[model samples]
Target: MPALPRPATGPGSRYTARAATTRTRPTPARAKPDIVALARRLTARDLWLTALIHEHRVLTAQQITRLAFTSTRSAQRRLRTLHHYGVLDSFRPLTVSGSAPEHYTLGPAGAQLLAAQAARDMTDTLWRPTSTGRIAYSPWLGHDTGVNELLTHLAAHTRHHPHTRLPLWLSENSCARRWGDIIRPDAYAHWTETTPHGERLLPFFLEYDTGSQTLARVEAKLPGYAAFTTATGTAPALLIHTRTASRELALRRRLTDPARDLGLRLATASLDQTTDTPHARWWMPLEPTAGRLTLTGLAVRWHPLTPATGLEATDADTPLTLPVPPLPPAPHTAP
Candidate 1:
């Protein structure tokens, strides 16, 4: 017999090679649900129940009802709804000694739903004010100005309490008040206790001076805040100068002088320009300095202010002396 014909090395081999390559490729992961849609379905009660099941694999309907403070009927209804939604899977034994308790466990879909809900909640908590779709109405506060930058930076830095709580007192129009409006500071802050006369009900008063016109406009409106505070018993006044050499210093003196007078003293930070570090971009008290300076008062703790720096030159003075490689010749086309 003729030597078995040698297999042809051509298109047949190429086809087999391509088929193998295609089989080796990985399938992409499934995407999670739409955040808005998921959030809409997540009731407070649902969240509570999901958390309960996540902590314990097998929970009785009665146990869930007791923990959630619902009647047996309500609990059963919720359980049935969750079971229908594929949030939970249930099983009932064929033989029961007494009244059979229905046991429930989170299904794969339920676990995924809970995880997605947790991620969305974290994101919502982080960027609260701006995430809520409210615009910054203080026209005097410019876009990307020092205060706005500070607010954005604080939003990131103060994700937890103390620093985080300060934002609750500020609003879009927080700084806006007619000439005589009272400055109502947050009475809840322990810092307000340091003020003389327990006048925590009064406003802290803030004023921004853009120019002579702005100053005159604010001066006319200041009394409204004072009258409002007196009537409501909430302190609500502060005047912040947008531009002025002694602005911060003057404010510090006014705040701290009374402490010294009362003999129940507090230390104050000096606003000396020469002592100003680059981190002094805003008037943040140096972190936990000695003595009574340790108290942060109503001020929010921000990240250490970092100045923008320029990139260093890679090749200084001398030219790049290494010879460049020659280019490949252009391909010739068949005539």
Candidate 2:
């Protein structure tokens, strides 16, 4: 029989062999929890707690109690609820010798849940009209001082228009769907108009662009509208751009060809950046008949696109009144 080879006999040889074996061994990956499922199981209060955990990473019950303004017992209950629902995985014990204070961490599931909630919140806030049925407006969308000024002006214009009822159809981070297969405008004004026959539906579509000088996203949406017009035989009546003269001029140049091809009408409004009020206050054009108007302004205004329930207007002292035409009538159906 062939002689069996002897194992290497050298100082540190065993250690080297053991080290190689250890290096080749695979480390098990940590298991992540099901965030979506955990979110579904949470109540409103539980969701709030989960959000804090997801944002801050790990929080202790005592800390959460103070931050959430809850009693120690209530905070403890909330923490236990999350852990039981699998929103949180392992917890760190406070100490080895005393009563263990648990520190919570968002499991994989919790992280996923928070992300999905944030996305939903963004979508809802962006597209929905305000509770007051007022026009939706946003300043952050404005790319620069010029664009901001324009938006401010447009907002003012809408507010001052008595003939035009500019109800918010969308705001930043709001969700909106279209009519049938057609692309609808970002914001809408539904007002009754006294036509020769009687009251008729007069819906105005408003589009606000900040003139960030990037039209990639806006241009992509145009094709959908173009297709819709071809199929439905209707196009948005108004396209508004809030931008500097140069930027607006440039947009006009680029959009002129498409506008002509799509049979879309464009409206341009200029905004002044020096003012520190809502853009609506500055840009909205007042009706000729609006002789003596009372304007009430709020320091911080809420989005009009959100559904209102018993929420008073932020500032009633300085209400804005203009001599615009009276609203025709409320739509029988919700927009």
Candidate 3:
């Protein structure tokens, strides 16, 4: 839930925008935004972007492009305009030398605009945002943005494959509400891939990691997944996305470890690094071969979790079937 506005000294208010940060030499004139021009240029998509950033908290420029636009150039252009108009605020994380991509969150105007767009009442008085210093100095900012990138890629992927339905996408915060202390994933989603035989609903928990997480640390999360499934008898797959192929390889060992038993079926993949698009070729399984498989094809690799019933019927005369839990509610998008 979005919090009410806080005092200026509030350290980490999600609803508040930070003091403006200058990328280069200070451009004092840019402080005052051209609100009128910005309002004139706003699109429904722009308002959607505002709502998205509001929901997810922060997004890098690349994630925004994948989520809302066809290309990075166009997305960046709009982001710059939004920032200039004080509708979106951003800061770059500390890099070794070269510049880092700007991370964005909803600005005061953007949040208010989104609330109004959603037909929600806005009665708060102190509408200021988090301080720029707080965002820049946040320790988990990079990790949070990495999770956003993974979810954004999944969100974008479904857009291209009309047959693939992303029914329920719960953010980390949303997951916290749904699962409480039972099992909190970086993101939780139910994907239904339509096929001639029928469709299969894949409920999975996302554990997106940058290169920073050690394999041991990765293994530590296994018990939680196992416990969740044991308690609910609803064993969802665990999809891990890492920064590097090496990291993916190392994590795979832990995921498929023979020594320690883990309940959740697991698959691993590297972050989508090639094109703006995501494809089956980008997803790798535990101890996978050279050829990659589509999301549902992953079922072949986790037989215990997804027991095969037989060859899926290709013709209308034959109906495809699988042994699994009762069909889930028709896929619906989570707010």
C-alpha local distance difference test of each model: 0.33, 0.36, 0.58
Assess candidate 2 and give its lDDT: 0.36
Would you give me the overall lDDT of model 3? 0.58
Per-residue C-alpha lDDT of model 1 across residues 8-37, encoded as one tens digit per residue: 221011011111011111122123324345
lDDT of 3 by residue, 236-325 (tens): 787877665666667766667632356456777765342333435566655536346556666545533532111133332111011111
Off by over 4 Å in 2: 1-164, 167-175, 179-185, 191-202, 272-335
Error of 3 at 301 (Å): 4.9
Query: What would the TM-scores of all predictions be?
Result: 0.28, 0.33, 0.68
RMSD (Å) per prediction: 29.8, 22.1, 11.8
Tens digit per residue, CA lDDT, model 2, 223-269? 66567556654433344544344544455555656765665434433
In Å, residue 129's CA in model 1 sits off its true spot by 20
Could you give me the TM-score of model 1 versus the true structure? Answer: 0.28
The prediction achieving the highest TM-score against the true structure is 3
Off by over 4 Å in 1: 1-147, 150-167, 173-205, 237-241, 246-335
Q: Cα lDDT for residue 190, model 3?
A: 65
